[model samples]
Target: NVEATKTVVDLISEQMEKGFEIPSDKVITVESSGSSDNVAIINCCFGHRVNETMGRVVALLLSARKGRNIGIEIDPYRIKLTPASSKEVLEVIKSLRPEAVPELAERALLDTKLLQWKIIHSARKFGYLSKDLDLSRINLRKLVIKLKDTPIYREAVREIFVEKMDVEKASELISQFGKSIKIKVYDSLSPIGLASREHAFDLLMPGKPVEALLRIFRQRLEKEVTVFHCLNCKYTVKTPIRLIGDLRCPRCHSGLIACFNARRKLEEIPKKELHRIANLVLSHGKKAVLAMNTHGVGAENAARILSKYYENDDKFYLELMEAERRYIRTRGFWD
Candidate 1:
């Protein structure tokens, strides 16, 4: 029996050796899972991103091992004990048991730290979390805008801000809030420190030299949606979180901090204000930062933005799972 398992493991190892990029450091071994007779597990599990890849690997093992392709009849061939999936993951979520996230992490066969962060971060995006889940130390500076009056166009701008970009929603927003709203971006351009004061350009003030403003905006916000100042050096840069390690200041390598949230900056604003912002950008001969609709005023590559931030480091996935469990017990399932 042990030899049969070993043979299966060897065939898998051989297949992995051929073309797979599975790490050499990973120990391919069999162990008792307590619930099953024998199990072959990847001790260094990569998580949910590897779902399809694992499916392919298993399919290859079944087809190539034991001399010929063997078909095992079953309702569904489940992959268990992988970071991305397992028997417990499917059963736990599918049954709507309201299991705490850590429990879910165990069921999913993922490291608790990495899993907790991923789930919490994802949940927070849509305002689902009961409290702020700010485990990540990524920082940025941002400008916040609030609509003057609740215009009919408020819905449209809100939709754009969130990057949902629904045509019908936009149209509905246009009809409801379209031309009636007025928007005002804040007036914090007065630089507090000497450096900002020296180059202190008033971006919020309407009808300033459009060309200079356009150049300044371009310089500050390119790959980054917005710009923020460094806490220590006061150097301005907007960097992605994944590349946070590379975000050291050119001068002092000090920390960067954001005053406001770049994404979803304006929670609720009037439609006319959204229109004004678009027109203001167009008048300046600059592309509207939030592009959408026929004129492309609020359009965005929504998936690209989400993909950048939703990345997870598997080793530290659910670092807060225990905290989450305790929180849930104190309050209720929604927590």
Candidate 2:
């Protein structure tokens, strides 16, 4: 197992050294004399670290050259290229400035979710951050900025490097590229590479389609509870939109009801404002209830949306969808 690990690591190192290029449409595979299952395990374990290390190295270098962030997937046995060709990647590798690695590595970690989680977890362990802190309430980028030069941040980076990556070995192999190691491309994956493919992890890229976003928005609306306040009697009731049917207030028998998110406290709101909301609901009817029930849309915004004329229900819904999308995109900033 030890030898297999070293062999897989070395194979990955060679591939990274060559800038991860194979013949067009051809796959590179590792050959082994050992049991295929053992080879697979070795590839999964060590190959991942090697590929990840090299992937970071290349990604950082490319990002520097291009003046923008570049993303890449580090498969168990390969470093998937972003917008760069094999030749360009090889040039970047060849021109690697060893002195810049520490800074580059740190920069590479900035956008990684793993590093962020590790930083938070380590901070909690060291009592720098509260153990029960609500992760959703904090801005991760700001947190990282605050902890950048602190011991907690350094410890997190160290743990990631020591426990999960073979950056030093990868660097050494890259340094020895021409002298002791060389690239060998293959037409297809070998038996061991095929075995490695059996347990490969899935890569999930970001961004959702408009339809998917709308579907999610619809689901959220269905589950959302709205507080209905009767202006006449000051009686309030909370009901989920999915279960809400009757529009009339049971206590006052009035259709003049103000709608708010269930989280809103009636006591905190001034009576005059509550009356205004009630008037809004009375004027717009069910449309005002729906607008208020929409995530992140307050009474004023709902009023603006309800006041606008739409050609049809579809156009009105599309406007609501845009409002929801805007709210989603900016909610973190709001927090």
Candidate 3:
């Protein structure tokens, strides 16, 4: 079973690298019995650094290995992932299936041009209109209210609304006020051009800084997407195909997923049966992969970490899976 899984993962990776098409015959499905605690426990210190889609795949495999079935879940906003051991479990599953689809976060950030301009315009209105309004003690909400009532706010704002202030600081202020006033600030703004020179601080980097790097990558090329599903609620979501960071689901909060690789597919086994799946992807720095979207280094990072273990050799994926099983059994982490 381990070897077969590995073969699938490696094959998938190779096909992706070669820009080859995925063969339907090669697709394999693994199901969970929906049991909790069947998933392994992992340290959450670096959880934020992990991928969401990758996390789900690890959780699913963990559940399957333990012979316990538990679906994963996600949150409403689809930002952060929930559940523990999501990273480790997903990695195991990703090692088995490498042809999954891309995630929403993976999609390129919407053009923030209009968003930035509007924010700056709003801020200028508040700052200039209030220049004589004695805004020192006025909280942000009251300031916005005054701006709406006074045309002086509009004239004052229109004068100083430079495109340069549209980046982070301007956006941050606008977003803060946007939330307070329930106004759609971004809808009125336009994006400024980036500084042609790396040293040019004149033009600002676009979009939210948190996902900036991922956004840049999405603009440049195509990448693979990792899909995540919850064992408890059966909620499903995909990871950004371009980002190498997270791979967990955003709903129902489950981390189980079937990740695709060129070799074997890593599946999540329950805590009681973690002995079967732990060591397959563990190494000096390899955080245990989970099927949940919220934990670990995430699918992209996990793939880089466990890439050494992936191979089309008949026994490679199986060997790692068995090694994980042995480690889990011997470690006695599960009761």
Top candidate, metric TM-score: 2
- Predicted structure 3: lDDT: 0.31
Candidate 1 off by > 4 Å? 1-106, 109-111, 129-229, 233-335
- Give the 10-residue window scoring lowest on summed lDDT in candidate 2: 36-45
For model 1, what is the alpha-carbon lDDT of residue 176? Answer: 27
In model 3, which regions exceed 4 Å deviation?
Answer: 1-222, 238-240, 243-247, 256-258, 261-335
Q: Which whole-number lDDT from 0 to 100 does residue 236 have in model 2?
A: 78
| Location of the lowest summed lDDT over 10 successive residues in candidate 1 | 186-195
Q: Which candidate is the best by lDDT?
A: 2
TM for every model, in the order presented, reads 0.19, 0.44, 0.16
lDDT tens string, model 2, 126-243?
A: 8887754556567878888899889999998998888757777666556654454543433334444443333221112123455665566677776789897887787878888777
Per-candidate local distance difference test? 0.29, 0.62, 0.31
lDDT, residue 143, model 3: 47
Candidate 2's TM-score: 0.44
Off by over 4 Å in 2: 1-46, 97-100, 183-335
lDDT of 1 at 295: 16
Question: Please, what are the lDDT tens digits per residue for candidate 1 over residues 129-206?
Answer: 434333232211110112111231233234322441123322222232213322111111111111111211231232
